[model samples]
Target: MTHTTRTNRGLLRGALTLAGLGLTLTGCTGTGDPAHPITLVVRDAALREIGADCAGATPYNYVHAGTELRFLTAEGTLADSHTLSPGVAVAADDRDYGEATRVPSLCRFTVDGSALTAGTTYTLSFGDRKSQDFTYQPGETAEADPVIALPPLGDPTTEDTD
Candidate 1:
């Protein structure tokens, strides 16, 4: 073949190779919805203030009626908001933490899977407290629920020892 013809054929082959590479990368990242639901847990030691009544109590860390759980995108845009009911007493042994094993309750909530996009990072925030950034892997769910342990409310050393 002529030199010009040979050069054109080489360029075509390179273009095809690049196209195939792009397809392979896309497949690995997954193009479909997540396989499992996204759940987030917001834990705070302040729940112990609800008193020893686990069955009947609604305690707030501050003066607010309830805590606001807000989900934000990587770009810092608000995605959605959920209400975290006032504290309900829970067994300390059930959610015992290191050293201070007197914690009372754990706050839990689930996010709608349809609202989340695969391979995207998100942030869970409660009031001014923010959880670590997490991402839902492509084609699958997060390995575990994102548990945000909020800082203790008021004094940590002043526990009711009665």
Candidate 2:
């Protein structure tokens, strides 16, 4: 065989090896889709909105305790449900109303995105309040944290049934 023929064969073999390596790496990486975890911030806005005359600061204490977070699919099916009772510890953000008034606390809950389907709509209902509907879009971009207002659950009349 000629030297040129041998050289050509070696070059072809190296090309094939590199191509195979690339395909193997691509398979290992799997799909580009990424899991998106939704973080919900529940704020007790009753004191802040309707003044401190509602119930006082103690009403805001453990605001998210025993709250139900339901993730409803677009077809109105229950995808998953999580109770915030023994979940993540409640966090408080107090705003000073006045020296004579007591401060209120806020809460936050994190939703697992494992069961969340991409490009699907979900209504996240908390307690007896009106639910907030949102679409799950998983991609390279990140979205701001969603805030769900946790009004004083003391009074059912105060709840937003709408």
Candidate 3:
């Protein structure tokens, strides 16, 4: 890579790292109170909303099926988990209010603990067949967007880490 390109890439990585550290200093996501309830919705490539995981002759229509979500504390403690599908309850768990969260889309995550942003709906997805998770913020909802675009898992240039 050229000197300028390499320098920019390094700077970008450094900025991302600092952003992550800042998020770590923040508290929980302020979502998922056990007393309250949450729900999930599934959509397809066509953005058709469905009541459950897609099945039968054309199962490709449902990508959210079989995806899992784990609500946790700021310290990575498990508050609750959800095997995502259409019309599934968010399974409110009083155990811990979510802080930071990991995503099923391997490398993707929300360091700011904004995955379950309240009163907002988001589409959670990565590559085809690689499911991701999101939440319908309490008191607000939206029609599911098409599968979202995210960075690839692991490093594309490297082989096995071992």
Candidate 4:
């Protein structure tokens, strides 16, 4: 075959290969829904349930309320943040994610050109506090529930122990 014809065939093969690669990358499992976005239900140490309306959670409220709840990738990339009551508001990465007719946005990531699956572990950060890295399952609640509480303010040190 002529050089030009051979080059065209080579390009076609390359394009097909790339297309397959893209499909494979997109075909992995993912954290679903932005509105029903995965939650990090924050409860006191007693699991008393702290919502966006926690009274004592002030100061730590603003930043701690909406500012907390950051979803970081296993590679520590900040994938998303959830900021509604119950905080940690993460929707899938879609522009219309918040709308009622939500497109299923699975929580997936690409690290170093590798597709990370949905059940892939992700870090949950509340302000400076971080929970153990974890993977999420669809329709899972306890996985999202975190018994997050701040240290008692101005408590005495060890010497004060009596």
The 0-to-1 C-alpha lDDT of every candidate, in the order given, reads 0.41, 0.42, 0.30, 0.35
The residue-by-residue lDDT of candidate 1 on 1-162, one tens digit each, is 212344443443333333223223333212132334333322332345322322212342431224566778988997766554432233322333656535544332333445666667778676767755666553322434222323222222453323
Name the runs in model 2 displaced over 4 angstroms.
1-36, 45-63, 85-105, 127-130, 138-162
The digit string of per-residue lDDT tens for model 3 on 100-161 reads 23211111122122335454334433222434434434432121211122221223245332
Residue 67 in candidate 3, Cα distance off native in Å: 1.8
Ten consecutive residues with minimal summed lDDT in candidate 4?
105-114
Per-residue C-alpha lDDT of model 2 across residues 2-120, encoded as one tens digit per residue: 12344444543343333223323332111122244454433432333221112213444433546667878767778877665322212133234566343432233345566777677
Candidate 1 global CA lDDT score: 0.41
- Which scores greater on lDDT, model 2 or model 4? 2
Q: In model 1, which regions exceed 4 Å deviation?
A: 1-42, 45-65, 87-89, 92-105, 109-113, 128-131, 137-162
Pairs that collide in candidate 4 are: 31-106, 31-107, 34-91, 82-88, 82-89, 82-90, 83-89
User: What TM-score does prediction 3 earn?
Assistant: 0.25
Off by over 4 Å in 4: 1-34, 45-52, 55-63, 84-117, 140-162
Candidate 1 vs. true structure, TM-score: 0.38
Best model number under TM-score: 2
